[model samples]
Target: MKVLVAVATRHGATREIAESVAAALGTALTDAGVRSQVEVRDAGLVHSVEGLDAVVLGSAVYLGHWLEPARKLAESFADELGRVPVWLFSSGPVGEQKRPAEEPVVVEDLVRRLNARGHRLFGGRIDRRTLEFPERAVVAALRVADADNRDWPTIRAWGREIGTSLARLERSVS
Candidate 1:
C-alpha cells in the first residue's frame, strides 16, 4: 500500500510526531515483508492523494481546535477519502494529560463522517525556550510547563496496527 501521512503543525512539535508516525509505518511494512510506500507531507500543501491505498491525516491542536489547513484538507478530500481507507490523529494534549481515547473526540468524529477507520491522539511537545515573548507569557500565565510528551512506542504500535488493517483490507479486496 501507498500511505500518505499528512499533518499540519506549529512550533515543529506536530511535524516531529508526524515524522515518527511515518517512520513507524515504514518500519511496520518492512517487517511485514510487504512492498509498501509511506510518505509524510504538510496537509496544507498536499494537492493530491491519488492512487494511495490509505491516508492518515493529522494535525496539531491550538486552543482546543485543529489548525485551519488540516481541517481544510479533510473537508476538501472528504469525497475521495470516503472511497478508501483513512485514519486520523492529533498531536495536542500536553504532559500527563495526554492519554489514548476511551471515547470519540471531535476530530475523530469528523474523521468518522468522512469514513476514516480510526482516529488517534498522540502526546505533543512544548518548548519554553522556543516560544516567542508573547507565547512565553501566555504559557506562563496558563501555568503550562515545558516538556516533550511524544511517545515513540505508542506511535509505532499505532502504525503497526494501521499497516495490519490496510493489509487485511487489500487482501479482502483482492
Candidate 2:
C-alpha cells in the first residue's frame, strides 16, 4: 500500500505534527506485517496524487481557516481524492483549551467533496520566537500563550486505526 501524508504549515509546528503522524502510520503498518510506503510532503509541493492508495492531509489553521495552499490542494484534487480513502486533520487551538476547535467552513466543504473517511482536530503549538510581527501581534491580541498542545498518544492511536483499516482493505482485495 502507498500512503501520502500531506500538510500545509506556516511556522513549522504543523510540519512536525505531520512528520509524527507519518512516522506513526509507518510504524503501525509495519507492525501489522503489511508492506506499505508512506510519503510526507508539503501540500503545495505535491503536484500529483496518482498511484496513491490513501492520503492523510492536514493543515495549520489560523483565524478559523486552513492555509490557502492546503485549501487549494483539496479543491484541485477533489475528484482524485474522492476515489481513495482520505483522512483530514486540523492543527490549531492553543492555550489551556486543548480541545480541537471547530472545523473551518472551507474544510467542511472539502470533507464532503472528498468524502473523507474521517477528520480529526488536533491541538496546535505556538512559539513566540517563531512568530513574525503580524503573527505576534495577533497572538498578543488574542492573548494566546506559547505552548505545544499536540497529543502524541492520540495521534499514534489514530494512525494505528488507519493502518488496521488499510490492512483490512488490502486483505479483502487480495
Candidate 3:
C-alpha cells in the first residue's frame, strides 16, 4: 500500500510529526503482510493520489485553524477523499493552555462529515523565536513555554490503529 502523509508546517515541527506517523504506519503495514510505503510531502505540492491506497493529512494549528495549504487540500479533494479511506490529524498545543489549543477545526469537522475512520490531535511544539511579534506576545502573555510536546508513543499507537484499519479495509475490498 502506498500511503501519503502530507503536512503543513510553519517551522518544521509539524513535518516531523508527519514523518513519525508515516514511519510507524510503515512498520505496522510490514507486520500486517503488506508492502507499504509512506512519504512526507508539503501539503500544497500534493496534487494527486492516483496510486495511493490510503492517505493521512495533518497540519499544524495556528490560532485554532489549520494552515492554508492544509485547508486547500481538504477543500480541493473533499469528494475524492470521501470515496477513499483517509485519516486526519492535527499537531499543536504546546505549553499547556487552559483549553487544548491544538484542536483543528477544518480537518476534525471534515472527518465527521466525511465519515473518516478517525481524527486525532497529536501534541505539538512551538519555538519561541519562530513566532511573529503578535504571536510571540500572545504566547508570552499566556505563559506558553517553548518546548517540544510531541508524544512519540501515543503517536505510534495512533499510527498503528490507522494501519490496522487500513488493513481491514483492504481485506474488505479483496
Candidate 4:
C-alpha cells in the first residue's frame, strides 16, 4: 500500500505536522507487518491522486478557512479521493484563547464530498517574528500570543489509527 501525506502550509508549521503524521503512520504500518510506502509532499506539488492506496491531506487554517492549495487539491481530485481512504486534518488555533472554536468550513464540506473517514483539528503554533507584516499586524490586533500549541502525542495517535485501518484493509484484500 502507498499513502500520500500532503499538506498546504503557511509559514511551515503545518508541514511539520504532516511530517509527524507521516512518521507515525509509517512506523505503525511497519509494526503491523504491512508492506507500505508513505510519501510526504506539498499539496501543490501533487498533480494527481491516481494510483494511491490512501491519502492524508492537511492544511493550515486561517480565519475559518483552509489554505487555497489544499482546497484546490481536494476539489481537483474529488472523484479519485472519494474512491480511496482519505483523512483530513487542519493545523490552526493558537494561544490559550484558541479563538476559532470551529474547524475550517472547508473541511466539513470536503468530508461530505470526498467521504473522508476522519478529520482532526489540531492546535497550531504562532511565532510573531516569522509572520509577514500583514499577518503580524493581524495577530497583534487579535491579541493572540505567540505559542506552540501542537500536541505531539495526539497527532501521532491519529496517524497510527490511520495506519492500523490501512493495514486492516490490506490484510482483507490479501
Top-lDDT candidate index: 4
Model 3 segments more than 4 A misplaced: 97-102
Per-residue C-alpha lDDT of model 1 across residues 59-144, encoded as one tens digit per residue: 88766778888898888888888888888888866755756343324675676677888888887888988778997898888888
Candidate 4: worst-modelled 10 consecutive residues by lDDT: 93-102
Please tell me which model should have the higher TM-score, number 2 or number 3.
2
User: Tens digits of per-residue lDDT for model 2 on 1-113?
Assistant: 99999999989988887888888888878887889999999999989999999999999988888998899899899999999999998998787788765776667788889
Residue 130: error of model 1 in Å? 2.1
User: Could you give me the TM-score of model 1 versus the true structure?
Assistant: 0.90
lDDT of each: 0.81, 0.89, 0.82, 0.92
After superposing all C-alphas onto the true structure, candidate 3 shows an RMSD in angstroms of: 2.1
Q: Point out the worst 10-residue segment of candidate 2 by lDDT.
A: 99-108
TM-score of each candidate structure, all chains considered together: 0.90, 0.96, 0.90, 0.97
Cα lDDT of model 4 overall?
0.92
Model 1 regions lying over 4 Å from their true place: 96-105
As for candidate 4, its clashing pairs are none
lDDT of 2 at 155: 82
Tell me each candidate's RMSD, in Å, in order. 2.1, 1.0, 2.1, 1.2
Q: Which ranges in model 4 have alpha carbons more than 4 Å from their true place? A: 97-100
